[model samples]
Target: MEVNQNDHSYNPGDIVYVFYRNPHTQDVANVQSAAVVNNPENPGELAIFLYETYYPLTNDMAVYQSEAEAMEVYEQYFSFE
Candidate 1:
């Protein structure tokens, strides 16, 4: 999908949080911070800069503006007590 400036709510340089699943520990997940940046591969598009990689911003991503927000959702579905 093509991304325009108006296509997403976040601006470049904005910090965003996301649930990151550990590669080796497939069952483990944690809330991690990522930076919103203009897609270097696709001009005018937005992507999440994390783990030294650029991931295109898509509708399926549950991106959060705050760590608390991310943790809240993470707990809702992933927490077991």
Candidate 2:
């Protein structure tokens, strides 16, 4: 599928949350990061790379299925209420 780069529907710098399970612990890791890239291959999807010390921990790369999924995970970790 071809990604429409001209589509202003979504921006690349938007903040979003993501929920992911750690392969080792089977624990859910919710993380938030800026939207890095969006294209046809990953349409309706967002990529969040693990940062150094403060963010999620990972050596390989990870991407969420959708924005809602990312937000849900982010809320799980950051939201108190």
Candidate 3:
């Protein structure tokens, strides 16, 4: 498993994009949401609550293959401002 190397940079209420792997099919879901818990006890990570509950983001859910992947999805859907 890849480990996060950067410092936690987001906070609760900040919108972020989480690229997750679907539990059933291993499909990628690049979704956006508000950060719920940034760097919980895990460090260099975050917990997000998806805007769409039909696809709830879980702690066990795989969020991005790497930081670069996450950033790519964020750039695709979210504004830098």
42-76: candidate 3 lDDT, tens digit per residue:
55555565543323334445455345767775667
Ranking by lDDT: 1, 3, 2
Model 1 scores a C-alpha lDDT of: 0.85
Worst 10 residues of 1 by lDDT: 1-10
Stretches off by above 4 angstroms in model 2 are 1-9, 38-81
Top-TM-score structure, candidate number: 1
TM-score for candidate 1, residues paired by index: 0.87
Relative to the true structure, candidate 3 reaches a TM of 0.35
- Estimate TM-scores for all models: 0.87, 0.32, 0.35
Alpha-carbon RMSD, each predicted model: 3.3, 9.3, 9.5
Clashing pairs in 1: none
* TM-score of candidate 2 against the unseen true structure: 0.32
Q: How many pairs collide in each candidate, listed in order?
A: 0, 2, 0
Task: Give the true-structure RMSD of model 2.
Answer: 9.3
Model 1 stretches astray by more than 4 angstroms: 1-8
lDDT of 3 at 67: 58
Residue pairs in clash, model 3: none
